[model samples]
Target: MKLIVRHAPLFALFVACGDPPSDTGKVVAPDSPSVIVDTPKLAANWPGYYSDTLPCLDCPGLDTQLWIRSDSTFIRLQKRIGLDSIPEGIIGRWHVVNGLMTVGYTGDKPEFYRYTADGLLTVDEMGVADNSKQDWTIEKFADEIGDAIPRMRLIGTFTYWADSQSFQPCGAEFSWPCTGGMDLGEEEGEPIVRFNNADLQKAYKQAVKRSGDPWTVEAICTLGMGPAAEGDGADEYIFIEQLPRTIERCP
Candidate 1:
């Protein structure tokens, strides 16, 4: 004998395929409008040299000179006022988010700052303004910070993509296309091809094998302005001078 089976209504199938009902028992559409967030824009006079003398416990004062470049990079020089030591230079990337600027160092905690009328004011990590009257402001000294590009140590992700190499600084949002050659003065006939050094390549390959492609690396490089990767304007590019080693992560 053949058994008869009952089937649900055709509308039930349609209900199963449609969007699930809301908590209020109403069908909610999946194609909802999204809220757009606007990115923070840097001030007109954001890029330049800023200087200030900060108080120090052991020394009379610390003469600090900060260079904020348009390429999302910064160079900070600090010298003890009465000490015989040379100025210490720190190189890293700077980024502004939610109206606060962050200076990210290679292996240190980020410093925060806020834009002021004349310069930048040091702030806490939570973006809170310094309450004491110790004068934590760095006054802008010059509008043009010179055209010379200095060789500095950088920690970033080195990637070879699309048949081209690039370096993304530890805290930067974008990557700069990289070139291999570096000037070796009058002694060398041609520039040293540092990027293709066997040790550097081996480290990069090992990094890729361990943590996938585009691994983090520490290197000494020079930053220069050049044509954008795919645009009509100019952008910052990196010229590798030395590849020190591969870093497990960005600090």
Candidate 2:
């Protein structure tokens, strides 16, 4: 008993100071892993404004009109052409890093775009086309839009992550991935898109009216932007994923 007492304190001290002898290994608590989403750290550029700087004039499908206020804080958008049933006014939070912007909405996960000083803006959620939330009074444009809007063909769609594109015509199609840091095309003249067929127009019109398949429009637009080709309008790109319609040439 004396021997046991003499060593008990030493054993206790060893257990206290030495490596833990539990075979359970590191007890990683089974607590839920926290999700780390990037929240925008507001910058000094309070009340800054960012819209489509490289305006997509007439890309097939989708309709777009996004205006993000600087501080990457608030945004507002509407249909630049045609009308929609989905409510406009997608009020949300935003983050801007360098020229990139991440917009976090109240009802949905966050998205990305670009903020610029030169009035040139770009956004993610692009596949081929896409929407905005605001006070859209389609009833007002009812006279001119007509039932055609419900089934407009030329207005097919796509949802693309639009960036400043230095588009190069690969084999047959124009591949718009270049290293020019969001080139707003030629910022000299107006940009425009001329529909070459009826199906294209109809598919697009349907999207503008329905905001669904066959023309899930994810359109883009800009202000002082132009096309690589000669034109009298603004530059445009079809954000495809967000849209269902396509300009797939008929067989």
Candidate 3:
């Protein structure tokens, strides 16, 4: 099978979650016996890239990559190994509160972080951490994020099914040697192409000629970073691919 995969640059792997206002509002001073001189400078050292392989319930582990910028903006990329699915990204605004950092997004849950001597560490909602915990630790890297995230490789056979009303493209998760019905509509942008009648007819005829059988299609796309934070819009797909194939049934 011919492979058509793309590995977006480290910066490209970033996805903007949603814009949440910066949490830089002034903190009301507490009335206490002791006086305070100045607020801490946590945000100064907070700009950089961090990554880790955390525990996963089903797959090998969750590969997480995060980028924190000086302007209080951040982006994150998450990938699930053993599952041939697309990598997901999030972009948002971030701020530090009493040494704890909060990354806010639109609909999903927020992520928290804390500063460390070596780098930034992922923490729970309460801003606490156990020194012995290393699973969620991400070390600071050079400005460029090259070679931080590992590329995902996928090889499989895809089948095309169509009718007067709809077109369905299905793909398998693992190699062709495995047996099971294919999963449909798992692609990130499959729905975007369904309305094109000309393309649909072309693909449908080719699949039918191949006896509606599966054909090996190798595709690779990157889930890279979108526009900078506070930019105008978000991309519907962080990753995309154009499969190069001469349709033929698998033997």
Candidate 4:
């Protein structure tokens, strides 16, 4: 017997029992009951501002500010205290697993954090708390931080399903509808011009071995609100600016 796994209009994956499907599609083993893959929801009090000054070997210290949004996305800002350089900002997806939170960035190893009575404490990759730590905890803020959305490079799998194109960012559970274009304006300002995404679409199509197959890709992207794929309300969408190449898998 075969099971028809449907991801809510995204795609209908046929899973064969006993024997794996000969097709090179990514499918869970027959023993697993869940067909839909989604990241675990964060705790109620997990969405907030977390900050700390970490010890730096070559500098005075590293001041870090992390904003955990309710949308599973995060903004991180870090600055060397004594350096003249400006603070570096990074945007990525955050998820919780096994009572620990992991922040994943494109092409970077994930960082883990464990919830504590006071706040969130830094932990190793194996979820072990630092032993000889000198204040590795990040204090939580009561208020939210106001920061602009920054364009970021994303590594994800692109799929053309149900006549719609979507991208699933690496380490992210949900896939967002993707639009190919370049916005030439400030984050809050109205975009004056829009660039076509013919090349990007062409690259994605060429990478797919079979129709409706998901292709791992790397691209520069921006997040914005748009019409939902199947609903009446709006949802967050990924705007692709540049498609570099199709990667073998998520790095």
Task: Quantify all predictions' global Cα lDDT against the true fold.
Answer: 0.70, 0.32, 0.50, 0.72
Give all candidate RMSDs, comma-separated: 20.5, 21.6, 23.2, 23.8
Q: Which ten residues in a row have the lowest lDDT in candidate 1?
A: 6-15
Give the winner by lDDT: 1 or 2. Answer: 1
- Please provide, for model 1 over 1-251, each residue's C-alpha lDDT reduced to its tens digit, 9 standing for 90 to 100: 23434443232222345778545554434544444555555464678888899768799888887889897778776778898344654567787877778786645778888887778888887778768768888898787566645565677888764456777877666777776544445435644553443445555666675423787877777667766768699776777766667788876
Supply candidate 3's per-residue lDDT for 227: 35
lDDT of 4 at 61: 86
Tens-digit lDDT track of model 3 for 1-251: 23344433332233346865344532334444443355444443777787777777788988777778776656666788777465554445777776688875534466677787667677887877756644667777745343322222223344444321211112211211111111225468555323233453455356555545555543233333333334686422222233435434221
TM-score of each candidate structure, all chains considered together: 0.54, 0.24, 0.41, 0.54
Among these predicted structures, which one has the highest lDDT?
4
What is the descending TM-score order?
4, 1, 3, 2
Candidate 2, residues 45-96, lDDT tens digits: the string is 3243333312234632235434444433343444434444331334345655
lDDT of 3: 0.50
lDDT of 1 at 122: 85
Give lDDT: candidate 3, residue 14: 33
